[model samples]
Target chain A: MLYHPLVIFFIEQGVPVQTVLLLLMLPVVATLVAFFRQVVGIKAFGIYTPSLITFALLAFDPNGLKYGITIFVSVILVGMVTRFILNRFRLLYLPRVAITLSIVSLTILLILVTGGMYQRTGLASVSIFPLLIMITLAEKFVATQIEKGSRAAFILAAETLVISIVGYFLVSWQTLTVLILEYPWIILFTFVINFSLGKWTGLRITEYFRFRKIARHL
Target chain B: MFEFFKKSQGFLGMNSRNLEYIRPNNRKRGMEIADSKLLCKRILKKNNLGVSTLIAKIKNYEELDQFDFSTLPDSFALKPNRGFGGEGIIVVYARKKLARNTTDENKNNVWIKANGSTITAEDLKSHIRNIIDGSFSLSSVPDIAFFEERLKLLKLFKPYSYKGIPDIRIIIFNRVPVMAMLRLPTRASDGKANLQQGAIGVGIDLATGTTTTAILGKGHLIEYIPGTRLALSGIKIPYWKNILRMSIDAQSVSHLGFLGADIAIDRDRGPVILELNARPGLSIQLANSSGLKERLKRISGLKIKTTERGMRVGMNLFGGEIEEEIEEISGKRVIGSVEKIKLIGKDGREIEVEAKIDTGADSTSIDIELAKQLGFGDALKTFEEKVGGRDVLTELSKEEREKLFSSIPDLADTVPIKSSHGYSYRPIVLTTLIIDSIPIPAKVSCIDRSHLSYPVIIGRKHLRKFLIDINK
Candidate 1:
């Protein structure tokens, strides 16, 4: 494919092609998360969590990893604060998680506004703002982080982001995307995924926690 | 108001904005109407979809009496218009003469002959009363009943179905026949092919319009119609494309996005619509074992040219291709092959050997020796075996035959089990977890179940509904 002189200039300046690929791998990553964790019984925070977090990171500040790390740290702080509050009150798991997600999402909104006051560079990274996606995701992360505990939830969130980067790239791959766009016959991959999962009979990874009684039987 | 949730996507993916994203967003789910027979009929009629002719609507007991019973066609089927699941349907095959000297008191009652037997007028009245009580309708809402011309049985299903008229059901989504199955009424189905009441449903090959493997009840596979060699396969549904197109057109007329249209073929009149189903039964999945979600997803946004175009595309895509794909996918044969099943009993004894399939039935059973092998010796001690022949028990020496039968107390040499749908039959059982390969405990019975096409009937409580597509 031919690129204009401006595009060549950007490449010469070492624009991150890998990051662009990573940015596109969202849905595939979510699907893979569901396949291995939901169908093949691998435990994770949730199938879509990490991928959404990554998309929000890229969509929010565009320094994909930097944005992802900032949001993750803010989400964790919200989770810790929520855990402390709930532990003091002894709130049930679901309720504590709910409280945590609310605070984290609010924190993200506040940071976005404050960035404008702080620096042009940080603010510039936020163009084509998907403020809406950020707010919703920030809430979910905070909640999961609180309810499932920081380790499990953050790990899931991190895994989701990484796999999403992979997914983002795969979807952007010229051959695959072209087939999907022009032929649309290629969405058969989704069919392939669905059909294979149709006969899944083993315990879900969540069930490992749900039915740990397997240990008792053994 | 919902826009706030839609636009507020802080971090939860767009899929989780509202509960609707996770669950299917149902915009036009037809309310669970009282399943009104009159309303459904009117809607179908208004939409130009052909349905059974409306004979007469009988409201209260007075109106029921007002309708001259003798004036009805000899073969007309009396039905509660609001009847759900074909319940409250009375098919009068023929009129039998009353005793010449019978009093006027018995004259008003409706008692007709059934097969070789005679059910009293009182029997007919109770069933009608049950129909009035909304025994068949989804609700207890009082309903007006009507009678209509009975569908002449299609020659295609004549062998596979036991005395009942069979109907083809097509599920139309967005003016396309997404999936379909043929419901065959059997003796067990009592002339009504309502699956819940024990009908045989065979998934149809969409492309060729031929019948494929059948699901007896939920999951039992049957090839030969009960007691007949009529190949269930290769029987093409008449007016196949016309039926699909008519059903799709009905979707446009009804304005219901999702619906199951049951259209039966009348030998004289061609295809006639049975009834419109808002929420069709899910057994279609078991019959087809193919998912609907994926098919729906594929055609969601794509442009379709016309009804014919969609039908042609659907036929070209989905018809007739499943058996090969399923066999390849599941690594199993699709045909219901005949095999001789062995019956074993207590102490590993060989009882009777019979051919049986794991019907989507709940219990395992055995013939005499088969039951004995299942360790029913202790149970046999209690039953006084009542043999069918008048002298078999008495002439064998009352004590001797009773001793022979009493060894299996639970053994009813003959049992009169009345099915849920108001049908009765006598079958003999010999006791056996129904030690099959599946470790299912069951009461084994012996009868001329062999006389029936399916030697076994497995009920739901036995199959556990836990998704097992056993030997095909």
Candidate 2:
């Protein structure tokens, strides 16, 4: 069995095999997010947020999934708590979000300090990319909190985290990475899946539950 | 999957709404105009449509710096040029009266929001600064900030709306208004007319302007205005025909194939176009208890040349079903002013006649000649032979009247009707009336109405099980 020439050439060159595999995994992960949104009706902060968070988590801690989830959760917790305290003051939206992001950054710093004290090397040496990605979630969180109440904002944040964790597990699968490296042409199927998802005119799974009272009214 | 698909056959979801209706029908130019409030107002104003008067617009910080706040009207609405979902809009109810001996400079220009929260000139400037920076824009791009004169609440909607102006959302497709809902502001929604913001969406009957059902917040079916005993349904909207016509005009002028026009009825100006939405929410289905998929498909791809024809098509296709809707909600069948009623005559023979429905009368009355034609000639003969005349019965004592009434066969009861001449006694007979295919056993009085247009009149006595839609 022969691999595609592009993959062979990239491996022959100085590019790392893991980098090529992760790059090819982007479409698969994005397609899975699209399926969850279009068919399953799980709207989790849109496609880009969850997919980026998944890759960032994989880059942060490749083997230990629990550590990445903890860091991401603490960022959201800090954002929500700060907004609760700031609700009393009638400040403008941009500055209030800026304060929330500041608090989130300080909390991340505390998490790293705690990690170093406990000799958890993975958390102590977390990369800036994943940490920044986690902190960027605070802006979206605060915006949703202002538009929709806190309960809805919490639900959306939890949904985004759940989808990211699911995407993290899929991308980190050993067998999938090996298969992608062997058969590079398999990546093209993601486009076909997305085409069908784009053309899908069916009711989302959530809408069936939303319109349960009037489902058969027609 | 197939079962779920079949169950949601008439529903229009977000994906299908975008893919089927918005993407294909809404052109880029039309969507662009819909996105920008400034452009939409200009175009709608040029078309001679009713819209809120614009006070001022701030394009950049330089313009914002030079604009004076005190010269504005006492009540106004501040909005972002390219916002969506009713975000980035601030509605001020009135200006705060200045104290006699105030020392502060910035406190002189304070205004109150719909929720009664006071916002000073400095605070408004900062909010407008954020708007100019595109904090609430759809794409987060730079936007313009503007202010427009606030519309006064109509007297009819004073009880239904909380702290904001209630508006009508009319969904239009192919120049035809498909479905419409009256959005009432609630305390939870902070006085905005957006449904997702906890406002009430009441479905309006197209043919007639009466409300049918109401949904609160997201999809909870509600019977009355929250925290009040005022019933949500059955309130008639004034100027309904003009509102529908303006929606169709807004659609054609904007060149959007599928759109939703947000129109508010000002106490002074009548129906004015508030905003035009390229992508409208689907929660209107829950409000109407019907799906958009079926309605959109019913009128898709038909050649509607004029706005009047489009409106007629919509009302004809989606109208007159409010009877079934009202029946589902209030458990009462709605009837028209003139209905075909089948009378069960002698030996089970049925005679159908067009009866005039009069809620003013206390009892159902049948013409004397029509009753004799229905094989009641023997009862009439026995009544005339036993009693001298209706005037004679009127002159009889109570005991004599009871004695004469007991002698007539199939006599349910007797009713005294007072006319301009004098009081008269009519013979009541027990019979079954079939109206709109619903069999109603009733006691109808036989009256001498040989000169009247209708042979029978179904009064309020038999209208307990039905509602009267006079226009129908």
Candidate 3:
């Protein structure tokens, strides 16, 4: 296949075939997130955040469930506290967000230092990418909290975590990863799936529940 | 059986909707036009269609600063041009009368909402700012805020509608109006006639323009208006035929093969187009308790020559059977084993009789003696002379039969009744009977029912408008 030449060239450049394959899987994960939102009717922290979290979790460790959740919950908590406190100051938007980011970074640094002292390598050795992704999620979480209130923010945060977990599990499946690596063309099918889903203007599965009263009339 | 039919027929899922209706019917340009309230208003007005007149529009921050609130009318609707669904729309029912004691800073007036709640001018300005900032647009893109004339509630819908004006949503496909639903605002929906926001959706008959079964938010089947005994169905919508014609015309002019025309009926103006939706929702199917797929398929490839032809075809094809629809709407069960029927005589004397329900018989038969007692004695005597009595009538030749039947000018009709004892020919007459308190003109055949327990027997012909429940 003509695509094999490009695959060989990437391998020759010292990039492992699995890493290249994982990069290609990002679109598939993104499409799944979109499906959950558009068709399944699960509103989360948009598409990119959940997909990034899923990718980070998958790439960090095969079984980084413990560390992944710790980082996720910690980021949300720090972000919420910083936002609640900062809200009273009524500072300008950019400066307030910058301060919140610095605080979130400091909190992550503290966790890393504490984990190293306890010799918990899993927490101490966690990559900066997932940490940064969680910080970005925190920004969204706090903003939503301020805009739509805590209840909506909490629901969206929980839904985002659920979607991320689902995406992480999907990417972690060894057989699925091997299959995608062997046939990179499969990534193109996500476009097909998304195209079909894009045309879907029907009631979301969640809408069925939302409109359960109307469904009962049937 | 009903459950299976409902599962198979009534609901149209999301996939079938986009692939079939939206994708093929709605064009990108058409959707853009439909999405922007200003564009829709312009197009509809250019087409000479009735629309709520625009009072003022603020396009940018500069316009917002220069805009004067005092020049506005006492009642108007403030809305975002790109607002999706029912969001970013604030309808002010009326303005509060200014008091003499109010100071300069407090000079800003208060406005009353449809629900009788008051909002200050500051709140209105903030809402308009949010609208201009694109808070309600589909993608949160910057939008234009505008004011429109607030439509008055039609008298017919005053009882049904709460604070908000009720609107009719007509789903048209291929220039044919496939289905329609009347959206009535509820307290739960905050006086907005958006179904997703918890308003009531009542199915309307395409032909007669009358309401049938109604479904509340989600899909609860409701028989009457909430908090009242007044049944939701059987409301003969005013200017129904005009509404259908206008919906089809809007679809034709917009060139959206599949469209949902939201039309509001003003107290004086009748129906004015509120907005056009390229991607109309499928909940209308549940409101009608009928499937859109079937209705769409029925009109799929038909060559509709003109807007009038399409509407006529839609009315003929989708128009429900009036009698059956009325029975469903009125929630009245058909008469069964026996019913108290009032028989009006030729002399205008009325007598109540227990009528036997017999679907096997073709026409109603009244006893000869009972007919005479009801002041039909002279007619019966003349019929006997013309037909040589009931006994000889069955024995008459074809020529004799025709001659005898033609000679009796008062004879409304003739029917042959075969009983265990013998067969006989009877003369029918036009009579009025009150069944189930609904007065109806019926064809009554005069027969010798002396042996029968019930003097009057209602046949299948007279029971066309009823359901015969043997148990009842």
lDDT of all predictions, in order shown?
Answer: 0.58, 0.86, 0.80
Backbone clashes per model, in order?
60, 0, 6
In candidate 3, position B194 carries an lDDT of 84
State the local distance difference test value for candidate 3.
0.80
Off by over 4 Å in 1: A1-218, B1-34, B97-126, B226-228, B303-305, B322-472
Evaluation by DockQ, superior candidate among 1 and 2 = 2
Question: TM-score (0 to 1) of chain B, per candidate?
Answer: 0.58, 0.73, 0.70
Residue A103's lDDT within candidate 1 is 77
Model 2: how far residue B86 lies from native, Å:
2.6
- Measured as a fraction from 0 to 1, the native contacts recovered by model 1 come to 0.00
The order of the candidates by TM-score, greatest first, is 2, 3, 1
For each candidate, the DockQ is 0.01, 0.46, 0.28
Clashes of 1: 60
Write down the TM-score of every candidate. Answer: 0.43, 0.79, 0.70
Ordered list by lDDT, greatest first: 2, 3, 1
lDDT per residue as tens, model 1, B1-472: 3443222221121112122221332234232322565666677677677777777667777765565655655566777766667766777665566657777755644445334555445555555555665544543466667767777877766777777788988877766677789998888878778886679888787766777766677556567676777666667788988888888776666655666788899888888887777666656655654545446555555566588977986786667465566656776434332333344445555443434445544444444333444566445433323443333422566577557565645555544454554433333453333323333444455433434555444444444422333322
Which is superior by TM-score, 1 or 2? Answer: 2
